[model samples]
Target: MSPRRILFIQTQGENAGAQEISRLVGAGLGARGYDVSHLFFYRKSPSFDAPPNTRYCSHDRPRGVLGALKFPMQLLREIRAIRPDAILTFQHYGNTVGGIAARLASSAPVIANQVSARMLMNPLVRTVDLALGMFGVFDLITVNSSDMLMDYARYPNNYSKRLRYIPHGFDLKTTDLTKQQARAAFGLPPDVPLLGSVARLNAGKRLDAAIGTLADSPDWHLVLAGQGPHEAALRQLVVEKHLETRVYFTGELPPERIGDFLAALDVFVFPSRAETFGLAAVEAASAGVPVVASDLPVLREVLASDGQPAALFVDAADRCQFTDAISRVLNDASLRADLIAAGRGLHARYSVARMVDEYEQLLRDLLAPVPQLAPQS
Candidate 1:
């Protein structure tokens, strides 16, 4: 049997959580004897190498009327040349483009993977809305959580069909580094209780609440990683709140240090206002660290819905609740231990291998004699 050609598309150069998920899934597929190709929104030329039968297509367009007009034409042309058997796209912008381009190129199936619930909540522009409507015409729609799928289905009158929830991929079998080893590697004190939060430095992340919660507890050291537009505001808050000692700003650590950082932390706090699937929290869980996250729809879907609310839950924007949750998780060793155990069990289901296998099954199922669509009427 010949390997099927799959095209994965993303319309950005920045490395966000969604892009990382796509890369992991794509890499997994490529390794498993599938012809997986990734298309970039801004690649000027094939500058780097990809896996066998995998390559990037340049889909750059300058920002203007000319660029806007030329984008669709260029996308159509690229799709025709690639001639992929199936198409997969990440992020809302890429999904819109891929949906339209795939239809124009051929009747082959397309997969629009929604990794961002933030984008799904807002009222999409008419153009993007039309593009999403095109998504209904595709073979399948994938979301990281049921909340995200519901977001897509919110406007049923305007929208077309149901979407499937395919959680973000992770390697649960990753090497588990000991707290002592991780601390030594990062050169941290062995005894101090460390609290960590990893996410984009944006207003919606609500890390200020975490700082406020930890301000009085000098012994409860906190580390805020990831850079974004809200850095100045967060830094100002740290000084204003007199939490300069309790809270440390490490900026954004590279991808390599993710496991190390998670390992060093005694507990993980995610105070984001919105998270389709908290990959950081999941990683912390896989590392056997207790997590404290916001009590939101998606957070519950990711953590609580599975009957494992042992991980402390608090309002994302509530400093009081955030502080209470963190304190409860940190001060009470028994509670933390239970939470970590439950988290590990829950994390087992989210491994990257399982994620890739699900996608492979979905693709194969979609290519079956009568392709099943989203399991909806």
Candidate 2:
């Protein structure tokens, strides 16, 4: 009856969505009495809290060769040291490393999660597709959404037979603060209707669409939270569309303060052209904010759900439609109320506790036949 050890791997120790999920998985599993260990590529110390049992491998990626020279050695040493019951990886590169390490270390179940669409990760996608073509290293490939799985129709073997659906869930806890209070705390005005979007400023995310949607309406304030490679391009688009006064780019905020941000926004807009599950949009809906987003099938599967539709989806590329969707949420108060209620209802389905329960069950089932897990270190 000792606690099972799970090694969670990541590359850059940044506070991106993937990193956040890794941190949450480690911390959450630890909270559930599992011995969790963390491994990073560059080995820089993380800003967020790591689990009690977390250990850093401190490996670095190599210049030319696909494998990290240091990680193999360090990971081998760590695996021998911890002898984890399983290894969980957050992204492609992490999966490659963790999966390979698990195979090298021995028959520890290696679980890999795919967070985004393969083709949409810029030009490097083909490289990933080719890498995924060799999935002999992976054990269980857990995806955040079925919509994400459906997208790999062209490359059916990207998942092979080890695919499993284990959606990433957010901590579902929010404050019962008034709109004015929430806005003031999150640094927003109570008067102007705020349309908030939280996503990396990447090409595939299509954040510029949010700015484009506001070309005609000068009254609505658009706040895009998070930073990425496309920051300069998005800023240039803001200038090009003459949205300097209406839109503000708040660089990536910490994960803890999201509730404050969600509370401040009257409407939550996700204009991303591509997403596997759109976890941020789910967070917004969980906050009970009216949600408007693209008609991307994956996003629709996650946010604009079938049982209870929470999102007003417009054509991803059509700014007119996107604008109309935003305007509809802003103009109609009754509609806003209905959307908020429906969003809350829909958001109820996605929570960290539920996700943890499901994932823990999966782990238990998979590890049922394995030897006894070690005690928490």
Best by lDDT: 2
- Flag regions of model 2 displaced more than 4 Å: 43-81, 105-107, 122-135, 152-159, 304-306, 368-377
| TM-score against truth, every candidate | 0.81, 0.85
lDDT digits (tens) for residues 1-377 of candidate 2: 67888888765555567877777667777888998877766543334444355556663334455454655787778777888788777766676656677678867877777776776754564465345535656666778887765655445565556677777777653767777897777667679978888887788878877888787787888888887789999899888888888788767777776777788887888877778888788878877888998888877677754466778888858878888889999899888887777778654577677777777877887787646668888
Judged by lDDT against the true structure, how good is candidate 1? 0.72
**Per-model lDDT:** 0.72, 0.74
Candidate 2: clashing pairs of residues: none
**Highest TM-score, which number?**
2
Model 1, 146: alpha-carbon shift in Å?
A: 3.0
lDDT of 2 at 188: 71
Candidate 1 lDDT trough over 10 residues, lowest sum: 44-53
Each candidate's root-mean-square deviation in Å? 6.0, 4.2
TM-score for candidate 2, please give it: 0.85
Residues 1-377, candidate 1, lDDT per residue (tens digit)?
56777888776544357656877888898889877877766643232223234333434545788877776677677778878888887777777766777777866788777766645344564357445655465567787887877776765543536366777777553446787897777666778889887887887778887777766676887887777678899899988988776677766665567777788888888888787788777767766878998888777777752576646778757666677778888889889878877777765667788889889888887775534467666
